[model samples]
Target: MWVFSWMSWRNSLKPPDSLVRKLNRLRRQERPPKREQGAKMGKRPRYHLQGTAFTGIWLLALGFLLFLSPPPDTGRCAPPPTPTAELVVRAKFPAGKPQPPPVTSTAAILVDAQSGDILFSHNATTRLPIASTTKIMTALVALEKLDLNKQVTVSARAVSTIGSKSGLEQGESLTVEQLLYALLVVSGNDAAIALAEAAAGSVEAFVAEMNKRAESLGLTDTHFANPSGVNNTKHFSSARDLAVLARTALQNPTFASIVSTRDFALPPLADGTKREFHNHNVLLGELAWVNGVKTGSTPYAKYCVVVSGSTEGVSLIAVVLGAAEDETRWKEARALLEYGLSLRPRTLLCDRGQLITQLDIGDPLGRQVNVVTDRALVARLSADQVATGTIFWEREARFPIRAGEVLGRLEFTCAGRSLGSARLLAAQSVETPNIDLLLEFWRRGWAPAFLTGRK
Candidate 1:
């Protein structure tokens, strides 16, 4: 049986023809009956028990090994850690020495006209009766509103009014320009009325306009009830607001010239009389750079003066109200002017087209470009303070850029505090080679490419 089993296995292992022929012949020839005494024992399919057991044992050992090992680090389920805080502290100022007491006055202010810097003040914002100083603003408004050459007929009301006058006759006709000189230099109250009447048709209307102008100039602490600054409870202004008015008046070059004149001649009157007037402002003749401003005095409003001058390229305006005496006001103004001239002006750090920084471009030959300003940089500062600062380049850009394009910014700082910044512009334009052109130039010689260029 073992031999037969071996032969069957070998025959099955041969080819399909050998196994098929043997199976067909056995089916056709075999007819032996099973003996009842010896029941045929059915053949049991042989099983590879050892191999199955070996596979089961190996799988069990692998499962135990995997259970003892750490889990795979997937890294997907972890939460983020908290961030740490960074603390910063600022510098503290040291205690400074005590400054001397400011000069006493009923009203006073020391102002830098260009910067609108108020260096000192005492009762500067308090409203006080302003006498002929009102004429300053009145003259300024007239000059701004009326044509200098326009003719004005002196009316009975102008000539009949009862105050300081240029001896104007009712029948006389004069140009507005002549009247302005008389009004300013002589403090002619009649001229003020005539100017108001000519400019606004009436004193009341002109005073209303004056108040309107004061409001527009942010002079909240002032009010005007009359054109001549005649004594009235409503006609009042503070030293600070008057300083603002003075600055505004100086903005008009015509007004400045008019105010600065010590003496000026008026056009001939109808009777062939020429009016000569002297300025009440004493500083104009006494000080070298002092120009014409205005002065005022009344029982209610003591000696007052608005003095302005330029020295060493610096302009200053000093306002003194209610001085103890006429000459003291001038003296105080001179001191203030001298003090202002003594201060050292700040220096400008940059100028137009000045190079501020460099930018890198990807070009092989010219790898960087300069960034510059389109205009001059300037700042007003005291002489003692350091004006050092740094230029910061924009991080997102690379350059080879066109002129006038904004490239970066310059930040000005002092004592770790930012002052201001100016924009940086490209100094010039730049161009780059295209990829195809670069590749062609790399592949071929320069002479050949130049000689046979594409149209």
Candidate 2:
């Protein structure tokens, strides 16, 4: 029985005769013929080693890349860190002194239109694009060079120019005054081009004239590259310069009237229909204090406005440039004008008995006299101006001064302009020197040093 079991295990291990014959036949068919020496090289051990090494290298590289890669996100992301607020101190002026109002404009200025005194400024000299505000200069140049009633035929070029049109047709005829109304009240680019052509025969010539006029007006930080106030690299003006231009433009009655008008209708077109235009300045009817000026806006210039306001005899011009929105420009301009008006006019610059200076009269007796202002000098001045005014004493008092006697003139100037002046008077009488004292003064070659002041 043990022998029979061993025989059965051997039979299971051995292959069948028919299967062995088929395996031998397949091996014979796949075998390659042997090559002669130097005829062609047989399969090399080096090739097999190189292929194995390449496979290993590729597997190692793939493993290295997997190790370096970041892990996949499996959960929700956390929110960003919250920012903390910081307290920033901008200015530390005196508590009582008026500070400039917070505004959104990149540049702004407030000026006394009557005296041309700058009441407030923020980046006033920085050059910035000024959109339709360019029409101020255009109107100024036109009023100076063209007649109001003269009719001008609209050119195809003017009508073809894009932006802010007044519905002007090519070959249409309109008077200079009508075009000016359209240009100022409506801020029409077509009217601007037409007026430019009418004034100088071409827009290029008119732009040159505009720059020439800007130079003549001493607008050092301003330049005009076009009449329509299109946004251009070469077209720019400063807040301070725009204030000056608006002040000058307000002086022209016609320009002033056109800018102040809320609504105007052009004469009927050839089809017997009228075209009505309204002022772009929303502050006109909304705020009683706001008067004539212009509004401007473009992609580069943002929202800009030059506003003129008069209240209780205080006339002011406020300029806001590069405001983020139309409402921002109007709000900031009104705030500036109101701020100027708040500074009371007719401020007492100098008190009646204020002692300006003391002087020695060359009396030989070593006598000093008090030079006091006889009357008060008052004028419209901002608080800052009153605090920093300069006095110019024109004449010095002579010897033998009497009480209440007008010795000489003393002028009070602020910001390069004279506010008011008063006569310097002796607070008390000073008797003339005796003959011997006069002789001693003459012998000592003593003279009054009042011009430079003794003390």
Candidate 3:
């Protein structure tokens, strides 16, 4: 039975002649045998040692080839994580203590000139005839557009002007600078007309320009029918608009000097006579800080005034229209100026070009770029209200950025309300390593070099 089993196993193990010949050829190719195999016992099967060795060698070679190849990855480079929003807290001013409103004329407003903030207003937007106070804007426009030393000849029509003696003879010549002083100081109607004609070739044309300028400056409720506030049906300005106009006019240093002066002497006339003029603004003499502006009165317009002054470091402007009396207008204007100066000044919230955040660009080299705000963030609040507000930053940044690129935005919020927002920009450029560079580093085994090059 054992002999029969051995015979069956040998028959099953036999290969075709072609395969047997190929195995014999492979065995012949070998240099020599490392060890001899034992002979098979009688009635027991003997395995071929060479054939087993050859099979094991082939299997080992196949395993080595498989090891050299990288494995197929079901998951490799992952997408970057999404950024989450964060909340920020800040301080703000407390509510100011309430106070009783002050009494004032028919129309009045006291403003902080530097901040353009109205501290007190009494029918400030009511339109009324501003009388000669309109000369402030006229003088301001001339000062801005005309060269101080440029000579101007008085026109025959300017000499024939009615009202307000300018002591000018026909054909009298003066520099633009001298005319501005005469126009503002004594409220010269002829000087105003002459300046208008010189600036725009005619008073009517100049009035058109004045109205155009007023519209451009956001004076929606103002109309100028004449260069001087001569009580025309079409000429009217509100106390609020006049305050804005006066504040704008005072921004020009030349206009400021002209208005502030107590007295000015005009250039020589054709008859070799000179005219000296005193300022019409009465507050300049009483208040140490009061500089110059204008005052006007007519039976139809009542009394009006635009007073500008600076006490300590705070500058104030007050405009009053349709006052019951001239002294009352001055008194109201003074009270408003005092109240404005009493309030503490507001500080600008941020400096220009401040760096707000840092953005990460997924460079293989691990480089980070900084993001900054394009313009400064600024807020004006009363001193008491400065402690309660909050500021927050929001960014929508991405990877692989260039310098000067816009990344996102920085927003300012106070008490859950958004006050303002500014754009965020990339402060530096970030570059990613190319495949060749990465492979070279991997080959060299310098792992730290790829990770440590950020600025």
TM-scores of the candidates in the order shown? 0.55, 0.56, 0.55
Candidate with best TM-score: 2
Candidate 2 ranges beyond 4 A from true positions: 1-96, 345-455
Candidate 2, overall lDDT? 0.76
Highest lDDT scorer: 2
The per-model lDDT (C-alpha) reads: 0.69, 0.76, 0.69
Q: Residue-pair clashes per candidate, as listed?
A: 2, 0, 9
Model 2 per-residue lDDT tens digits across residues 205-305 = 99999999999889999999899999799999999999998999899999888889999988778898878988998889888867889999998999999
What is the model-wide C-alpha lDDT for candidate 3?
0.69
Per-residue CA lDDT of model 1 for 178-278, tens digit only, reads 88877877888888888999999998999988998899899988899888877899889999999999999889887887888788776666668877778
Winner by TM-score between candidate 2 and candidate 1: 2
* Model 1 global lDDT (CA atoms, 0 to 1): 0.69
lDDT of model 2, residue 377: 61
RMSD vs true structure, all candidates: 24.2, 41.1, 17.1
Candidate 3: where are CA atoms >4 Å away? 1-101, 268-274, 345-455
